[model samples]
Target: MTDLNSKPEIDAPEGPAPEGLEIVDIVVGDGAEATPGATVDVHYLGVAYDSGEEFDSSWGRGQSINFPLDRLIAGWQQGIPGMKVGGRRKLVVPPHLAYGPAGSGHQLSGQTLIFVIDLLGVS
Candidate 1:
């Protein structure tokens, strides 16, 4: 079951945001949402939100990964649970919540991106 609770960190109650991503309800849904520290497994595809250019994806690599909630980006930690088994979601992540100014293994910089994520299951 997917949980839907608005969080201050993800929702950024203090307006747009200073650093990190914010969730805007473009398509509000009836599904379970992720807790701040819940471990989950999923499939996802990321693209530049502004340019619509594809950057990364589990689909492109033909594989899915299961990692601790702490192992992923801060934005994903707050973004995954809205999707249930066989469900999908669009996560718009800002650089701060992602890899920040330093970026990560993906070389992502101050880029805002969108992810078309498919939640296969949670373990």
Candidate 2:
């Protein structure tokens, strides 16, 4: 069972990166569902697909984050909707949907990222 209070672990991916976004639910919640543009409170961990190196984590910061879905990456905007509070989800986001192409200037550009997100609340 997934522990919503703790940070998640992502195994190194095998083979080539996927061509598109992949969303998987780890723990399904029974609370209010999230809308496409809703603000959310979540705890998340992010890692690089190729190296399995951790890039970011809300748990590392000692708290969850709250933000509007539309203000995040495309992968998030597309992946977060339909989730519910108390759920945990994994999203494999390609470069285009994440930080964009190699020269897009964001540190994570040109790379595929994996995120395990715990939904704490939605508004």
Highest-scoring model, lDDT: 2
Clashing pairs in 2: none
TM-score of each: 0.66, 0.98
lDDT of each: 0.61, 0.94
Give me the overall lDDT of model 1.
0.61
lDDT (Cα, tens digit) per residue for candidate 2, span 54-122: 999999999999999999999999998999998999999999999999999999999999999999999
TM-score, candidate 2, is 0.98
Q: After TM-score superposition, what is the CA distance of residue 115 in candidate 2 from its true location, in Å?
A: 0.4
Write down the lDDT that model 2 would get.
0.94
